[model samples]
Target: MPHLIPDTGPQRVITASNFVYTISSGLYLTAGVLYFTQAVHLPAAQVGIGLGIAGFVSLVMGMAVGHLADRHGARGVYAITLVVRALATACFLLVDSFWPFVLAVCAATGAQAAGVAARSPLIRHYGGDRPQEFRAHLRAVTNIGVSLGALLAGWAVQVGTRTAYQLLVVGIAIACAASAAVLVLLPAVMPGPVVDGPRWVALRDRPYLLITALDGIMAIQFKVLTVAVPLWLVEAITAPHWLISGAMLVNTLIVIAFQVRASRTIDSPAAGAGAYRRSGLAFLVSCSLLSLTAGMPPWAAATLLMVAVVIHTIGEMWHSAAGFEVSFALAPQHATGQYLGVFGLGAGLAEALGPSLLISLCITWGRPGWYVVGALFTVTGLIAPLAVRRAEYRQRFRPTHIEALGKAPVA
Candidate 1:
């Protein structure tokens, strides 16, 4: 279990920060939209629009902030982003109209994305010899934190009052602030010497960009459980409605139990590609299983849905482990934060677009649509190995990895 919980002070500090940060995220995840509609009393359409704007804004902020970290320093920048998120969360209390709501959400989402990219350098600096595996440990800690935070937010949801909702929002703000404060316990991570290349070198890497694009398509699977399954269960199937929570619980528990174990094997970019391919086929099978649950009776539907979720959860683990491997392995150490920021674009796009895509493909079009979505995943997975190979060829030629092999860099 040391793999699950690393024994070093630095690792523990990072884990603690991630735990608190993700707990705040969990608080917001469950009640964020509801708080605006229920407590602030904004219309649902406005809320949706505001969130959409926030999502797109976040995509650019991460890259910018990450580059900032590469030039200045990571530890302080990461702390600042968390504090910004905290302040933005506090602004939720002041939101009264569409513009105010939009302003708050955009800042909050932007900081959250920025913090993730900014933390990459810190993770690499402190994550021992293998940052990828440490990242896996953080992921497991994240699930535990999110689950606890969700459970805490459940009380507020159950209360169903404006005061209670406001309290939850305030608590989230506190959690974020506390998370930042926790980071001060860790040592500072100074920026590496600025390389004499283009400012946005990561963006210029065409092969890596290809890998990012494919990963983005594969990232849509994230919404399958959170968005698609609940909607499908309610609208299309006869399964008990409680299965929504059941499915989430199942997925969360699986990640908590096995994410570290899963990452143990994906130690390189090529291994990550293989994991992606396996996950794609698993997702296809899971999607197919979920489709079959559509016309079954309640007991049968429930059984099939449960099985689908477990299969999907397994694939999710593989997908995540693969991401950790490739994203960190391929990044230049000097530009780790900035490269990770670029890497995040794929997942950010998936977050922004995945819900709509899943709704249109899986929920709106019915069973046949599941196969289409599954095929897309499988195809993306199958193609990833090639993408990684291209990226590998590209990276080997780059001065970073080449110079590491005791050879003089090529120009």
Candidate 2:
């Protein structure tokens, strides 16, 4: 099969760096906590609390670091974040207690968040005519990298020893270090010229903030397959437990295969908003399908679950594609990093809170709750286009509009 790697050397370099970094993410996400609990013997509650704090830290750091990237050089700032993440990850060996663990986790998480913001400018610069499409390609590559890393982590988990866990952590640390070194191959991106406007323009742009909020709400769908579907399969349906893995496999494969293609048609901010609307409706239909599987027979339940997963994944792809398009296009080029950083806050909050909400509504509340979730997505979708229009109108009518972020005509 043809690949999604960038054709140019520098772009390919970025793709390589991103792939390596995301591999570490997959490894850590899969087994980092296990290392603490199984190897270090920390209590579960402390781990949860520490992770909660780290989540908040990450959100705050993303914007601050992103602003720094806008003022300073993105490549340098990005490398620093990567180095910090590597160091913090390696420091897991020193975490013997609650507070120490919190420090390490927060540092690593914050660096990860900051790194995302810092890298935005680099992506926008090298992404050719359609940076959004390149983002989709990277997303596809990320799926592959993460899946491979997860498999490696799975092997470590299966070994189930303190030394094995230690090795896994060290491996991810090394991976992060390697990724930072790899980043040096790219050409340096100088700081953008600061223009006359609000220093924290992204924060002051009400339309952008509104879009970010809506995106945050829609981001809860990311949890559906991971948290809600597995639980629903166990509690309400008679489908084999193995189907859990099957569902995840299907999602990963679909994303790797189709994420780029899905983003191809979403060429502008307005199109991105329309994509959001379509994605929301797709989520709604998937939720409806999920509700129907509750009382079905085993084979039927399994089939329905797979079907729903396909629909849900389609929605997920669209939502992500829309995010890439709108977030990048609506943002002023001079402050791309800052805008992306601000945009990330919504998803960050969702990551911290989505699981509990899904547990309470989609899982605990049963089938009826599914409808409520669907309706929420639908309503959000219906309103997004309106927001995009308002943002466009305001920008157009302004006496001094930003050329870098000016919206194109929407059909």
Per-residue alpha-carbon lDDT of candidate 1 for residues 96-203, written as tens digits (9 for 90 to 100): 999999999999999999999999988887877788999999999998889888998899899989999999999999999999999889878766775676899999
The residue pairs found clashing in candidate 2 are none
Each model's lDDT comes to: 0.90, 0.90
Give the runs in model 2 whose Cα sits over 4 Å from its true position. Answer: 397-411
**How many pairs collide in each candidate, listed in order?**
0, 0
Please give each candidate's TM-score: 0.97, 0.96
Q: RMSD of each candidate?
A: 3.0, 3.4
Quote the positional error of residue 404 for candidate 1 in Å. Answer: 5.4
Cα lDDT of candidate 1 equals: 0.90
